[model samples]
Target: MTDTTARTIPIEAFGPGAQSVDVPVLDSHLHHVEAGEGDPIVFLHGSPTSSYLYRHLFGLLAGRGRLIAPDLIGFGDSGRPEIAYDLADHERYLDAWFEALDLRDVTLVLQDYGAAFGVSWASRHADRVKAVLLAEPVIRDIESSALPEAFVGAQRVIRTPGDGEKFVVEDNLFLTAVLPGAFLTPLAEADLAVYQAPFPTPESRTHLIRFPRNLPIDGDPASSVEYLARNEAWLASSTDVPKTLLTYEPGFLVTPTIVEWIRENVANLEVHAGGAGVHFVQEEQPQGIADAVVALLARAEAR
Candidate 1:
């Protein structure tokens, strides 16, 4: 059901020591890129991108620990099933990925939609998680009033019935616009193409389209709301597990209002300014992100 042949993404796209491992997850195979070895540092990328997103950090942190980055089901080169690409759908396959790889004592690096699934897993399996590194993460349901006007307008267009599909699928806004626009420094055509490669066809962009649509707007997508509530409880309760929140300027999900909210709500959370980026902190501040993870790993070991 899976290929162990390990297709290699060009180092040109991701940097040196990049290779793919196809593992049987759930009903199909999942493609993940990995490098180095030690305590596993699993990088979970958010919407509209794949394992390739962490190409820079994978080698940078090789001296510290194993770096494993997976393309969520229906994203990147991972298996694409004809299921509704909702939060539950992503989490179900991701749980299988964890089991398949037998990952434990995980240092989860989360961003964007990846936060939704990764945080939910870490909260439930707090015993398995060693630490968490978050950047521009979507930790809870969106508070529209706290959001930037531009972002709100964009969301409105994307969530609109006919417009959503045209923009996300047909026009391929996620890769064409959203991904490119997130970075503080613009991505080169070659580097940007790597992220764009996965969803070349509109039909292949099922997850990209659904990710925004499934966001917990006005308490809609009842399941995601319930999931975030549980995640919030776990975040507040799990003080034993270390949590690092890396912040950046002009961030979308981790905005100023959300930062204040996180301070009051999440327990045992240490927030550090990660320079500047809009949403894709990994794209803009890989070094800062890597340093934070290294520090968290050191702290975890010391404790």
Candidate 2:
């Protein structure tokens, strides 16, 4: 059902490595990237993707602030824990990882599933979060299709009886099939290499296959649904968290109506639109996103 031919993302093509280290998790080394100086900005990525998502951001902001992007337990160079991976898994990982580094006064930047981890983590430590920037995070329901239309049937397909692995396929419809011309900007060949590096083998994609099992839309996608329920309640009551909606060229999957709905709603939300791409903004416009994050931080400071 999968290919074992380890696909290589030519290492030379990637941007410079800012800083690299590993978190101790048994025999596995959780690869992490640290760059920049001053206040720390810990980035959390979602399923099937790793710190590779922030290669450009890392390069752009490495001199401005300390950037720490890690490969979650089941993805990238991290140890595949052989356990089910989901939001709760990410929450625990973020809790422990940040604690290990003693990260404080963070400007947590998140996107996609990263939103779930970063937001949930920030809500737990409101005093630590200075500001936030999100690219179609997993804040609301998946069907909302506000961030990326890649949401709708992807989860539905994978959660089926035997189609679990389909969602994590190397040539994922989300990226190759659906994302082709839709994502904000086409990913640079170098950047695309990073996102494509983790799943070198079909069998190594166990996490990818299982990632779909964690979607909370269904009855109980993963164990974190309960935590997500709690996080939603927190998002509703908490007014201290400064959040922004950075919109790019999204596809029909995420109709303008859905994104507009968020633009109209959500308190303390600043929505900016001026680019194009189906979903992955970090890929197409890395510098733009980096600037936007810095700008949002300034806005939060002014208020």
Candidate 3:
């Protein structure tokens, strides 16, 4: 039987009756929020955000399946182990978490670096994934010049040695600047505080410092570039799997150029507009995102 018991996290932003869980994975544990019961519909969040990113989606997607949103290791309520916290580290932890839960026939809702993690995993385990829904995901290698000037500048600074530490660790730029800027409107102080709670000290912000540097910009990070290429090959060839891309007006990552590339290349893909937003489409279009996921699920069921 499915465990419908509610586990509490002291954050009002998660709203009332949020169900939390801490599952053992590797040397650490992954914290997640779950609702309903059936085949797993897993929600994976990206850098600087946690399971709280999908708090609204649980209710919106209620009764669709077992809704689960987990905070990637080193983020949210999850244990911060002594490790490099690189893409490989995150992937390893996530692989263990999925095995621990014994999730099967999963429908994935992914965004940001979560895209990299989920898509790569799905590529390796195609039979296990039922469907995929993505919004502003990191799916390919990007030229540093293709990014916005301000973003490129920020990445350069964050990739620097001492400067990177000061920018993310001391200043907490990811939570204070990058995250808030992703939303179309300003995030409320209360909601922002929920994201801030996990990383209270400079040491706690190690993952934040590492994430930007790990991006596959200009193919400098060969590992990430190779990883993305592998997933891209799977996306192009997996014609049987249903895929949905939720796009927002003037998106941050999935810009028009990239979207066009995706539509042309990825097989069995459907594109839906998620209204006006930047990187964080869920905050601006929770209902739209929910609708898209439902539509994808129906398509997968039909197949």
Candidate 4:
């Protein structure tokens, strides 16, 4: 059974915010920023970023639907428990959040790790999902050969045992460097700080450090690869659900070859070129992402 009570929790306002709501998902309180009315447009962000990632879209798409962006359990303004923060851990909290809120006919807007986790959840409940919009989604296992050499080297360093902890946790490289470097237009210091504020200590960043490790590398993390496989099959077969993939120039996850593969493979999935960026398209391309969501809703309505 799912708890449908909407509990408002206190969240520190960062930049211009929406209505910040706190709902208990599992033992920890999960925080989300929300606004608007009518059907729900739920924004799920990737690593190191929170609902703050969708601040720009909150205003842009307020008229379009009910906008909700929740910080995944261990990240953002949400509670950080002393847990492993693995793929299953993330899904548990997210599932609870959805049930607590009783979100239905949802338009799931996803990016990065958000795509990996959210898409899998949406696929499982295709009847509940009204539509899906993806930006630089990690929908399948990636090839090392497809990535930039510099990025590959950094990934290796992050994957190494002690080096991974030192680089991501001790130095907070994801917030300080990797995140800033992903944007085509550099994020301002204040904006950067908003992303960095949640994980002030190494202990706070257990989830961040574990995110890259959760990636399906030679199927070592069997659970994550299984989820990816499920979603990929869902994308290929689910025609009733409206799916949109927003591609960008110099993209990281959705390379040119992957774009072609998606076009040929994923059923009822529309691909839109969203201009230039590598990974964090939200920083540079919020309006485009919002527009795509609005369009998806309209298309779904028409059907």
Indicate which candidate wins on lDDT. 3
Candidate 4 lDDT, 128-229, residue by residue in tens:
888888898877777777887877788889989999989899998877888888877888888788788877888777668788877765454677778787
Candidate-wise lDDT, in order: 0.80, 0.63, 0.84, 0.79
Indicate whether candidate 2 or candidate 4 has the larger lDDT: 4
Evaluate residue 114 in candidate 1 and report its C-alpha lDDT on the 0 to 100 scale.
Answer: 86
Candidate 3 residue 93 Cα shift, in angstroms, is 0.5
Off by over 4 Å in 1: 1-16, 217-220
Better of 1 and 4 by TM-score: 1
* Cα error, candidate 1, residue 301 (Å): 1.0
RMSD of each: 2.0, 5.3, 2.5, 3.4
The clash count for each model shown is 0, 13, 0, 1
TM-score of each: 0.93, 0.80, 0.94, 0.92
Of the candidates shown, which would achieve the greatest TM-score relative to the real structure?
Answer: 3
TM-score of 4: 0.92
What is the per-residue lDDT of model 1 for residues 193-241, given as tens digits with 9 covering 90 to 100?
A: 8778877787777568778777775576787788788888888887877
Candidate 4 achieves a global lDDT of: 0.79
Stretches off by above 4 angstroms in model 4 are 1-17, 217-222
Model 3, TM vs. native: 0.94
- Backbone clash total for model 1 is 0
